[model samples]
Target chain A: MRATVLYAAGDVRIEEVPDPVLHEPTDAIVRVVRSCICGSDLWPYRHMKPDPHGRRMGHEFIGVVTETGADVGRPAVGDVVVAPFMYCDNTCEFCREGLHTSCRRGGGWGIGGVDGGQGEAVRAPLAEGTLVTLPVGADDPLIPSLLTLSDVFCTGHHAAVCARVRAGSAVAVVGDGAVGLCGVLAARRLGAEQIVLLGHHKERTDLGREFGATDVVTERGGEAVARVRELTGGDGVHSVLECVGLVDAFETSLAITRPGGAVARVGVPQYEQVPLGRAVFMANITVSGGVAPARAYIEELLPDVLEGRLEPGRVFDRTVDLDGVPGGYAAMNERRALKVMIVP
Target chain B: MRATVLYAAGDVRIEEVPDPVLHEPTDAIVRVVRSCICGSDLWPYRHMKPDPHGRRMGHEFIGVVTETGADVGRPAVGDVVVAPFMYCDNTCEFCREGLHTSCRRGGGWGIGGVDGGQGEAVRAPLAEGTLVTLPVGADDPLIPSLLTLSDVFCTGHHAAVCARVRAGSAVAVVGDGAVGLCGVLAARRLGAEQIVLLGHHKERTDLGREFGATDVVTERGGEAVARVRELTGGDGVHSVLECVGLVDAFETSLAITRPGGAVARVGVPQYEQVPLGRAVFMANITVSGGVAPARAYIEELLPDVLEGRLEPGRVFDRTVDLDGVPGGYAAMNERRALKVMIVP
Candidate 1:
């Protein structure tokens, strides 16, 4: 089975790896049909040296189940499914609370000894709970969009939910990445009255508008905050979605969030400390949101995608084969592509 | 007028000051009937040297409107009213959003050029909006309880409200001062099923119990969090009310808050920064709350106090005449009293 593997900084390769098989009653073998490069992957690809043993790369995927273990019940072989970035048993207290990201016995794909998702076949732990079967056929053109349910789309939804977006909320999304663009979609789905996308890239901002952003503030840092305030008539937005993991994004999220509002962050935090004490207490804003519980959100968000009401797939501006995974990373890293879909 | 004045650390004095007179069209002259020393006051009293020019002290008060400015509307002269620690014009955008603490024209009593509430006669800005009239006579025994509506009690209420306290919430209050004790009462009033008071003082904890703390964790910092976690079956409390301004108290509040839960802090944060990035984001916890909008809550809480349903003033363990205001600060600073009331 061919899989994406990282050997060192900027050294991504498609290499033949052993095909995964069911090792536990709770496990299943998923034949990867669609996988994608994540923004977070670029962190290690651009900075740290990959393990000498070669590290498996991808966490976001959509696939067909090739085989199921004895303990698997619902999802049968040949069924198309969305695999959230992390796997969980779905019955742990945390999972029951819809926080599968904090599942007591769960681990993420491609990390912590789990087989990565960007492969011809990968072993899925807790397949019964971690995989959500799509009602649509495997050959549907919506595959790329459905692929987003595994991560970015659900992450965006989590940000909106954390910010408590409602029918009349004025929302600001602080990143122009795929996840942030999806946040515009999610905020619209939640019926936000106005949406502000703070990004400088014309291409991404255009996509953000298509995803339902009512306003675009092409600025950074304090200037971006000023722009958002100016757009919101000086009260600032009711909710802010911090989708970029950078400190500036977090700072701007806090700055432009109106008093009594919230700044919900789905971006993986990169800063070791945040200045909530120096500012938040005085402004009375709720600093909320974290890793998205994608599995919990799949069922609720799937119908919209299946009905052709949502096109999150537009975020996948480029598509490639397993062999082109490295090129996909390059495109994303160079800001030439919003996201890359790898069809294995 | 005679008022509590801060001359230096350990040198609180009852000094002669110019009597307050209504200067603005919306102002009111209030004869202080009941005022209490707050926990925040001890900060300056025990830490910083007061400037040679004496600064006015005290913020919590219930008083009679001795006179009204031209624009004063609701509470006329002779009305007994609870003066929220801060004053705001109810018409401002922020005040309309129940964030009077951030109102454009809002100002805190006893700080930033405003007259202190402990004075014999203090002119209140935004008198029409900042004062909530008491239904009962000025001499009612419940005046003490009604006075708490001016700050601590309402502040605690703000903490619980900001934390989004629900009917079955398991709440932990991370302070033993009057405000924390009031949080116990506030959480109970909001229908929390279980409340934990994280304080070591027997006297204060006893008052906490009376205010409906179902459990008390006496340890501080990490140990206190361990006790709280143990009490909540290792998942942590559904909500934490941070009523202590210290950094340790803030840390414990975040530590003890359950995943997807929140810590609401109404304790004027004394810390410069907090490590929200270390744990909060991963845990899906919200750090919210700030200065209480006491004016927003006073009306809703007054009937409960007037009807004897809530007795927040039980937190006042000591009382003094106007001339003994200096001794009141002394007792509170020395830790001999939980709170002190000045009978002017």
Candidate 2:
């Protein structure tokens, strides 16, 4: 089986790897049909240290179950399914509270000897709880959209939910990445009255507009804050979706949030310390959102995608096969592709 | 007239100052009947730099309207009124949104030429917006509790509100100050099923238990987190009201918050930066709350205070006359008194 591995910074390769086998009664052997490069992957791609033993990559995928352990009751052999970026038992107290990312027995893919999604096959832990069976076949035209249920789309929805976006909410989305664009859609779906996309990329911003961004601000830093405040009539927006985890983006989110507003961050932060100072405190601002509980959100979003009310798959502007995994990473890292879909 | 002044850290005095006069069309002269030293006031009492011209002290008071400018329409002369710690025009957008602290034309008392609440009389800015008329007389037994509505009580309510405390909520209050004790009361009022008070002070924790703390954790730092996690069945609390602004308190608040929980802070932060790191981000913890919008909350909380349903004034364990203002500050600063009331 061919799988994606990272040897060091800017070095992604597709190499033949041993096929995965079920190691637990709750496990299932999944043959991946679709996976993609994530925005977060760029972090390591830019700074990973050299290592003789390469690291497995990828954590999003739609696949078909090839085999299952005796105790795996759902997503039986031959069933198509989508797996969230992280695996969890779903029955833990945290998972019951709709926070699967914090499940007591949860763990991430491509780490701790688990199989990565960007491979021919994956040995899924907690198969019964992690995999959401898809009604449609692998050849369905909606595969691209369904694939997003694994990570990106759910992440964007998490941002909107955390920000408390609702009808008549004035919102600002701070980023042009696939997640940001998806946030615009999510906010709109949640009935936000106004959405301003803070993106300099015309191509991405154009799609952002179609996805329900009422306006776009291409400025950066202070200028961006000023522009967003101006667009919202000087009160700033009711909610800020900080889809870019950079410090600058976080600062901008805080600056452009109105008094009593919220800033929801979905992008994995690159910095540790945050300026939660007197100004933010005095303004009654709330900062929330985190690693999305994709498993919890998939069911709610699936109906919309299956009914054609949503088309999150539009974020994938380029596609590659298993051998092109390295090129896929480069395209996204160089900003040449919004998101690259890997059809293996 | 005499007013309290802070010349330097540990230096407080009752000095003769000019009588306050209406300086704006929206202002009114308020003769101080009751005021109190706040937990936040201790901040400057500990680190204030020496000044040739001292800073005016005190921002919580219940007073009588002595005179009014032409534009001051409410609280006619001779009316007893309670002023929020900060002044704001209630008609401003932020004020209308219940964030009076961020009002467009708002300003704080005891700063920028405004008369301090510890003075014989204060020139109340935005009088119509800042002063909420009291039905009771200045000498009413309820004076102490009414004075708390100016800051402490409303501040605790703000913490509970921001933390989203509600029916069945598991709440943890991190502080034993007047505000944190009030937070315990507020959480109970909001129907929290379980309330934990994290304080080592027996006297304060006794009051916290009376106010509705179902449990108390006396341990500090990591032990405190462990105790709280143990009390909550190892899952942590759903809401953390951080009334201690120290970094350690903030960290502890985060450590004991369950996934998807909120930490609401009302203490004037002693530090600027916060550890909004990967752990906090990954747990979907929300950090909210700041300066309380006392003006916005006064109306809703007034009835309960007046009906004997609340006794926030119990926090004031000591009282002094105008001449004893300096001693009052020292008493609170040295922890000899829970809170000190001024009967000027």
Candidate 3:
């Protein structure tokens, strides 16, 4: 089977890898139907150290179940399904609490000898617990939107949920990546009355406006903070979604948040330390959000996609096959595409 | 009027100062009946730089209204009232959102020429907004508990509230000071089923248990984290009240929080930076809470204190008159007193 592999910085290739097979009674073999490149994947693509064996890539995918182990109770063979970035046993205490990402038996895809999502097939551990069955067929037109449930849309929803975005909420979304754009959509769906998108990209910000951003601030750094504050009547917005994990983005998120408001960070933080100094302390601001528990949110967001109320699939501007995976990485890394979808 | 003043670290004096008078149309002069030395006061007492004019000390008090400016509509002359540590115009947008600490027009007591609580009288700014009138008299037996509503108890309640403590929650408190003790009570009041308190002081831990700690772990650092995780079935607590603001305490709070848990910090963080590294990000831990908005909580907690359902003032183990305030500061600074009550 052909799959994506990272050999070193800026080095991605589609290589033949051994096919995955069910390794545990709780496992199932999933033939990948659709997968995509993620912004997070760019981290290693930019500066990953060289390795002889190489690392499998991708953590998001929607596929059809091809085989199941003896203990697999659901996701019968041939069922169309989507897998969250992490696999987990649904009955764990954390899973029961709707924190599947923290499940004791959970593990991420593409690392520690597991199958990567950007491949022809994946051996999904804890199949019944990890895969959410999709009602549509594998080739359904809604697949693009439904594919987002694997990580992107659910992550944006996580940011809004963590920030407690409500119908009357005023929100500021920082970053213009696919996740940030989805966050604009999530904030709108959650009824945020006012949203300011802080991004310099005209094309992406335009999409952000379509997703319910009432205002756009193209400034960066202190100027961006000033613009956001100006847009929200000098008090800043009630909630801030930090979709960029850079320290600068985090600082801007904190600076533009109103007193007593929340800053939910969905981006994987690039720095080790965060300032929780006198300013943040005195304003009574809250900092929350981490890796989204996509499995927990998929059920709630699926119906919206099926009903045509949400069109998160618009994030995908380019598409590729297994052979074009390497170019897909370059296109996204160079900002030529907002997001690239892969039809395996 | 005599007031507590800090000339330098370890140098406190009760000196005669000009009597406070109404300064703003919204101001009122309150005759001090009860004021207390807070844990935060020790911050300045330990290392304050000498000044030609000493800084005023103290920020918690209950007093009787002596005089009011034309615009002061409530707490008429002779009415007993409690003032939050910071004075805020309760009508401000921040105040209306139940975040009076962030009120646009709010300012802290004992700073910028404002009269300190440990004085004969205070010119309470935003009088109609800052003072919560008590139904009882100055000499009421509930005065001690009522005085707590001014700061200590409300600060603890803020920690619990920010952590989202609810019925059957497993909570851990990381300090045994007045605020942490009050946090135990708050957690109990909120119906947390399992409360683990981390403190080494037997006397304070005893009070913490009385306040509703289901278990006590006296270890520090790694041992403390292990003990807490062991107590909660190796998963840690769902909510952690970080009443100590040191980086070590904050780190422990993060370490012992269960995945997807919250750490509410009410302490004045002594450090400038906090680590939000991969460990915290992957666990989906939330770090929230800040300076308590006492005015917003006073009304909700007053009824409970009035009915003897809470006895937060038990934290005060010593009393001092105006002249003895200097000694009161020493006792608390030396750890000879849990908290000190002042009568002017």
Candidate 4:
């Protein structure tokens, strides 16, 4: 089997790797139908220190079950499935509570000692609980969009849900990445009255508008806050979707939020400290949101995607064959493509 | 008129000050009948640098309206009224939104140029908006309880409300000060079933129990978090009222809150930054709370206070004449009294 491997920063290659097999009673073997590079993947792609044995790459994928272990009942052989960003036992207390991201008995794919998703064949743990069937053929053109349910799309949906976005809500999305653009769509589907997209890129902002952004602010920092306020009649927004983890994004999200409002963030914060005491208290603001419990939300949002009510697959602006994975990384790193889908 | 003035770390004196006069269309003059020494007052009482012109010393008071400007209505001259901890124009956009603490046209008393509540006669700014009538005489024993509406009781209530305390919720009140004690009562009034009071002081803890504490954790820091966890069947509380803004208190509050729960804080935070991003995100916890909007809450709670259903006035453990305020401060600093009620 061939898989994308990262030996060091700026060093990505598609190389022959041992094919994955069902290794445990709860494991299943999946034949990768679609995969994609994530924005977070860039962090290590640009800065990871050298490692002797190359590391596994990619955690987002949708595929078909080729084989399953004895204990796995669901996701039978030949079934098309979506693997959430991580694998978790659905019976855990945390999973039962709908916080699969914090699942007590779960682990990340392609991270730690697990196999990566950007390969011809991969092993999925907790197969019965983690795999969601698509009820369609894997060769469908909508595969790219369905693959997104593995991570980014579900993440954006989590951000919207946590922000309490609904009819009568005024929301501001603070990022232009694929996830942020999806957030605009999620907010729109939730019936938000006004959606403000904060980004400078024409390509991204245009998509954001189509996704349901009623306004766009090209400026950053304090100026961006001012623009959001101006757009909302000086009252700011009832909800803010912070999809970037940068400190400045966090600050802007908090600044543009009205009193008694919420700032639901899905970004992994980069700062060691958030000076939110006085500001949060004085305005009666609720500072919440966190890592998207993608698995918990996959089933709930799957219906919308399958019905063609949402087309998040548009976020994949380009596609690459298995061997062209390197160029895909280059294009995304150089900002030439919003996201690149991988067809093996 | 006489006023309690802080001239230095240890110099508190009853000094003659000019009588107050209404200087604004919305102003009124109130003859103070009662005032209270707050825990925050000690911040300067024990640390302020020496100065020739003493600083004003109080922000909690219940008084009789002796005069009103032509524009003022509602509470006529001679009516007993309670002044909120701060003055805010009820008509501002912030106030109209029920966030009076962040009112655009208001300022706090006893800070900067505003008159202090400890004075014999106070020129109340935004009088019509800041004062709530008691519908009773000053001679009523319930005067001490109504005086709490000016700050402590209302502040505690704000903490409960912000923490989203509702029926069947388990709550933890952090801090053993007057505000924290009141928080226990507020949580009970809001329908919390299991209230955990975190404080070691026997005197204060006793009052906390009377106010509705079902459990008491006499530890601080890490140990305190363990205690709270053990008390809640290791699942943590549904809500946390952080009445102490110290870093340890903040950390303990977050540590003891369950995922998707809220922590409502009221005390002024005593730290530069709170590294809350990762902790808050992973658990889906919310950190909110700040200065209480006392004026906005007084009316909703007045019936309870006036009917003797809530006796938060009992938090004032001692009383002293204007000249003996210095002794009152000494007793509180020495831990001889939980709080002191000032008879002006």
* Tens-digit lDDT string for candidate 2 (A1-344): 99999999988888999989888999999999999999999999999998778899999999999999999999889999999999999999889989999999989999999989999999999999999999999989999999999999999999999999999999999998999999999999999999999998999999999999999999999999999889988889999999999988999999999989999999999999999988898888999999999999999999999999999999999999998888889989989999999999
Report the number of the highest-DockQ candidate.
Answer: 3
DockQ values per model: 0.72, 0.83, 0.86, 0.59
Q: List the residue pairs that clash in candidate 3.
A: none
* C-alpha RMSD over true interface residues, each candidate: 1.4, 0.9, 0.7, 1.7
Write candidate 1's Cα lDDT for A173-202 as tens digits.
Answer: 999999999999999999999999999899
- Residue B156 of model 1, lDDT score: 92
lDDT for A301 in candidate 2 is: 99
Cα lDDT tens digits, model 2, B170-195, are 99999999999999989998999999
For model 4, residues B77-139, the per-residue Cα lDDT tens digits are 999999998898899977887789878889888776677988798999988888888889998
Give the TM-scores of the predictions, in the order they appear: 0.96, 0.96, 0.98, 0.92
What lDDT tens digits, residue by residue, belong to model 4 across residues A169-284? 99999999999999998999899999999998899999998888999999988788888999998978989999888888988998999887888888877666776866676777
Per-residue CA lDDT of candidate 1, range B1-344, in tens? 98888888888888888888879888999998888899989888887676988778888888889999998887899999888888889889899989998899988888766789877878899898888888878899888898899898999999999888989999999989999999999999999999999998999999899999999999977888899999999989989999988888988888898888889998888887777784677789988899999889988888888789999999999999888888888888888999999888
User: Which residue pairs of candidate 1 clash?
Assistant: none
Q: Candidate 3 — number of clashing residue pairs?
A: 0
Ranked by DockQ from best down, the candidates are 3, 2, 1, 4
For residues B1-344, write the lDDT of model 3, one tens digit per residue: 99999999999999999999878899999999999999999888998999879999889999999999999889899999999999999998889999998888999999998999998989999999999999999999999999999999999999999998999999999999999999999999999999999998999999999999999999999999999999999989999999988999999999999999999999898999999877898888988999999999999998899999999989999999998898998898888999999999
Top candidate (TM-score): 3
Model 4 scores a C-alpha lDDT of 0.88
Which TM-score value belongs to model 1? 0.96
Candidate 4 residues lying further than 4 Å off, grouped into runs, are A13-18, A23-25, A53-55, A69-73, A232-235, B7-11, B47-54, B111-113
